[model samples]
Target: MTDPFAPLPRPRSDLTEPPDAPQALTGGSGVLQGRMLLQVSPARVGLLRPQLDAGRSGLVLCGPNALQQARRLRREEQFSGPLLVDPAVYEVRAASEEEPFPNACEDTFAFDDPLAVSLAEQRAMGVTAPMTPTGYLHAEDSDALKAAVRRVAALDDPQVVFAAPVDVGWLREEDSVRQLIACLRLLAGPKALMLGGQMDPLARHPRAVDHLRRIVAEVPGAALLRTDLAAFGALAAGASFTAFGAGSRLRHIVAPGEKAKTSKNFSTSPHVLFPELMHFFLGKTLADRFAGADGPVCECASCEGARTLDSFASNAGDRQARAASHNVAVLMQWLRTLTAFAPGLARQRWWHERCRTAVDRYPLLNAQLQQPNGFKVPPQLKRWALAAPASEAALPRADAKDYRSP
Candidate 1:
């Protein structure tokens, strides 16, 4: 169902993405959701058929020396059904706990730790997305990411041009944001944008909000890619596609300075989302608060009765994956619905409605949203907020108060 080449599905009248999702979108099992893509290591190609059988797509992203394993999987028929393979440059070296920060001046990909997959090899493989070794860049290297984009294209390979990730943290800075967008504006053809790294802070930042509009305008044809599981809002904002993983960690970017690590345990469950508030509460204690709140607790078949306050107290990872699955499922459904609405009009309506509902759901979160005018609520959104929704009783206005950093 996820043929990357297939044209985007027409928007449906019953769409439930942002501005309008039924409670079920956030409540059910996300496994087998057709639009969802499972990001896996080369060895995990075994998951291809299982995910495909369950109505999902499998994507294999290799790093460093994983080409051989990727080739083997490609050679086998079990993984050939509409698959996408890309090269990912993960960590260069393990981080020293004492020296947590890598030089911001250095390439995000370590210099010595290079891509094992060669140009000849990549061409022979006939992969899906041709990705050059890219990661976070130093402010000096804003040009580096754009340079990498050209390097990947010069090879005359893959059908899609995937840009390396833009560190959201860096994108929040005024100068860095200008440089990155300026570099992207220079690109001649379309490319996929992967926004990564510590997100919550970036999401709340003022500069990042306005810059997002420029990212979309400059690279009008560029695809906005999301792996940062919480960026469904970005889809409404302008991300064209998304990437997901076999485990929860794959769904979000690794720490800026940290090397990639695998967890043997399945992610635990009950990471409940108060959609209205956009607040996430981990563990059973927080989830129990929503018991009987219809669709608040995950009811994915896997966690039918297994998800509970007791299960989380034990701190099992399997429990976390359940909630994560539901979260992705909701996002997938949201993307599906988005296909039906026009980008600007529908998305604006959706964003406003979600904020309205969010305020209605939890006024406390609004306290954070109300943190003053310097934030990016988008001009259209700000206008909408000023009109009908903001004045509604749903959002109780707080008396003028001093701003406190979150």
Candidate 2:
């Protein structure tokens, strides 16, 4: 019988580290220059202090206490990198009329109001880049999106970023996505942040994914927020930057009116990133798979020479903290590797090749682990792997108005 706990073979090319020849790109906000941002709740601020202090990543504060957290990080931790507070106004707009608000949601509304009020509050909190407040973009309404874009364009401060939180399913409507792209183009600067409400990881439908690709490709400085690993696909499609949440709930937007279950049957394991596979699994699931045996090893700064893939299984707070840190470190390495290449075709090709390799290795990894059906590649990842490198000449221009909605 094959040793299911044995380490899987490493890929021929190392995709985690930067190459020696190419010079890393600089200038502009790190977020706009292709660096990944880490979004975390106030309670988890200290968890990523190492990365924050080292300037390896930027931070986006979410949750009700985000303002207070930002103030503390600046006053106490002295984190000087790009920092922003998510106003989370989308939650209010997403809530169904009769649905009761969660504690977090209620607290968010107590501070963050819509439009100008939220911007003012963020400014007072000393947010490095204050995002213009926006409401949820439902499939049927383009007015809210249009107004949000215009509001950002009219703002005198260039540091303001346009935030567009939208229904993930709305991407299926070709016209709606086009409208979004058009509104984004109207912004004074190339600083637009897209939030996919209830997207989980990403849109699975082919058309929806394609539409997302179009938005990322067409928008000059488009970045994805709360995207999780799907941020890789956005980066592949030429996004300026992406942010992944530190925990499962923060990883994706919760749909309006969706209430948390009160059930106690849920597993307490923190989700750990399997870098080679480019997917996250419950730590317990990983422990079970590698029971009594060694599994893949991570060389990320957090895991180097000590933590193995299965070691993150414990549900203890400290273990969860380490798991989160390890995940960020691994993602930062990948970002460095991706950004090392010249932008456009070179970067896209490298990402596609990496995805392809991950896809091909899935079967072998599963077979070796003695679980033939396990480790399926996500549909979006498969799409990226199979996608041809986008031609620079064919890409949409920043000012293209052909798809603009009336």
Candidate 3:
């Protein structure tokens, strides 16, 4: 019998590539090979050249505002790496100060009327931008998603492809998965799945991760990616590769569109995102501020010489690039570490163990996964998380109002 779960066929052009050391990735001589991509805005694309030169490999992602800039770079023949364009069609596509992006609808039908608004007033705050037509989103029905794919594909680069219906978080129905799978199967090539917006990667809605894993297995050639470091744990679930948003909070999601700074109280930068935690700290300064006499907590290439408190005050572009570079390092190291663990569930277990340790080390980090604003956690994932070793023991007791991760 044909196995539905069997691996899918590879792309004709062979879009995906072998990692720097395939043998290191897979114990087997001819084993696994893949690329770790970077999801950056047009402003950050320049960072790619250095990363590429540094022996780091990954794709680049951009929003609409930077699309032309990215294209110019491509046409200039400056960057030879894969480039991805995001089409945030989950909601109304509109122009914002940041760029032209698909933003959450101003008024979700759920609260179209004041009556319904009051009925669920408590949840009103939880509903973020891009509430999506049916309380979630899908590119299958979006012409924008289709058009984006065509536009990117038309770029005539095998390395390019568009990511749509980025998240299946609100896709609660089995048919939803099946339908989306049908659309996914029809994608041209160099397929990539994005876990965008509202997803707490560490504490993914249980079903969303399952759906994601299913996609990875079914389309073995597709890249399972997340711009947000929060969802980096998806790597454990059999994701081929993950791009760090420079670990800056700016590397975020929306249906494909997806925020921010200070002094000592500004230890975290609004734009500078930290992994394992939902909060953003003051930029390089915060990172430098936290630096002990020995040195900054992060000695990543980007963080070097950034130990000065004023260094954190570096302009957004410089600081963003530095933060992004550091995140690339973090993801690559994990990729290598997981390589030792064969493939499949074994890799996931390795990832989970590390995540478990991190959560245990800093319980506050779990705040990102808590799905604040009355948002319910995916039941399946909540159960799965609870089953982890010391899961409940490590969590703040229900009565504990304060959680300080010292």
Candidate 4:
């Protein structure tokens, strides 16, 4: 399940100069003078006054709802940072609608070509569409991934972005995995962001960590590696900044492996999952534990205002909706934490302590579940199921400088 000795692809020679050079890639304009990443649904974009006012560095609209919300917010709210919309959102555009924005939001755009505004327009607004990986990789067709990367690289502003999380699913073949990593590294070039996508559900095996170690090793220059809060603490060895998932992935099944099993004891559907017994239950509980943990010590409103564990549990709603909103808030909080750490090392000790604190709490959840058939989950099985657990192996370490500046 882990790729070893994969033929690493050499760096590509096509060096396209960014038309708008020196400007930040995404999310660099808020009151916070650091890097940030946020994923919001369209429904909540209008309500992001808290996020925009909080001084977020940037926001990435994941789905149509998020993109529509961003466009609406752009009209309503006066944001200071770069804004991003995923390409998938543009695909859903109604031909009747005008160009999605008054102007592009960031250095790189994420929408498809038909909906894409002119490069001149993006440059004028300090926006670019540095191609980003959508976690949909076709293993048989490396060229497709490479071609997508090339198209993004050839943009007027060539800032490549990808979020190909290395997890158990990706571990099916070590060579292909290595090739994918090499391809990503090549795509990112001298400077790129290796944003780690969610690996929580896929982490049900120990080899997942091995795969993660290799993925981290192959891309040491990533701007930041984002992940789930609970998983982040459990797998801190591979990352720099501690981050968490936005629950979109949690709500939707990534593959057949994650489908709910009908058990006499507990139904696995989102509606049936309880919010409290996360380890013991499925959906809602899984999301609540990850979002409420404060594993990253994020200082955002959601983290601070979450009066109690119960409050955090209900922040988003029932199962799926809760995962989406809570995770988005957590990711927003992560950006805030990064801002506090940047421009200096003042927050390094605090960051480590936060991670350790979270890691320490993981076992307690398991221990609490073991109260006379309360729910005994095996540590070996537990450890194996994470996307990137800690490893004794000496994986490569990305320099803090890669993401220290705006």
Best by lDDT: 2
- Deviation from native of the Cα of residue 100 in model 3, angstroms: 18
- lDDT digits (tens) for residues 1-406 of candidate 2: 3347634322223222212221222223433456567888888877775754244368888887898998887888777777888877666554222211112333355544345666677777777667754655565466555555545554533456777667676677777777677666554344545545443435445666667778888766677877676576677677776777777677766655665432132366777888888877878778878884687777787777587888877787688888888887777777666655656766666667777888888898888888888677777677767676756344323322221100
Sort by lDDT, top down from the best: 2, 1, 3, 4
After superposition, the stretches of candidate 1 with alpha carbons farther than 4 Å from their true spots are 1-82, 93-126, 156-160, 173-175, 188-190, 199-201, 244-248, 251-280, 288-321, 364-406
Per-residue lDDT tens digits for candidate 3, residues 1-406, read 3347634333332223321211112211011134455666666666644544223344444444544654565566465454444333333342222221232435556335421232143122211011111111343344434444333333333322334435444334466666555544444344556544543433444555556556655553355544553234445454444555543333444542342221244434434434333234456534443344332354434454444322444545566456556555445545555554545555555545555544443434234334233122233333334334222233223322221111
lDDT accuracy of residue 183 in candidate 3 = 46
TM-score of each: 0.58, 0.79, 0.54, 0.54
Which tens-of-lDDT digit does each residue in 1-406 have in candidate 1?
A: 2346534323333212211211111101122122335455565454333323233344546444355655665675545543445444433321222211223224335553233233335546645444444554533354455455444434432243445555566556668766666554443333455555542424545555456545654553444443543234444455433355544445445545654554322233344433334444455534344343422333433344444423453246454545454444444444444434555445545555655555444434334444333112323233223323112233221321222101
**Candidate with best TM-score:** 2
lDDT of 4: 0.38
Q: What lDDT is obtained when candidate 3 is compared to the true structure?
A: 0.41
Candidate 4's residue-wise lDDT over 1-406, tens digit each?
2225433333444734222222222322112123344444456554443544244445555553543455455655655455654433212221111322212235554554432343333233333232242333422346554554555455422233443423244444677667656665554322322222233433454464455546544553333323333333222332322222233342212322234434342333332212122222344344444453432232334445443333323323454444334445544444454444433233333334444444445556655544333334434334433323223333223333233211
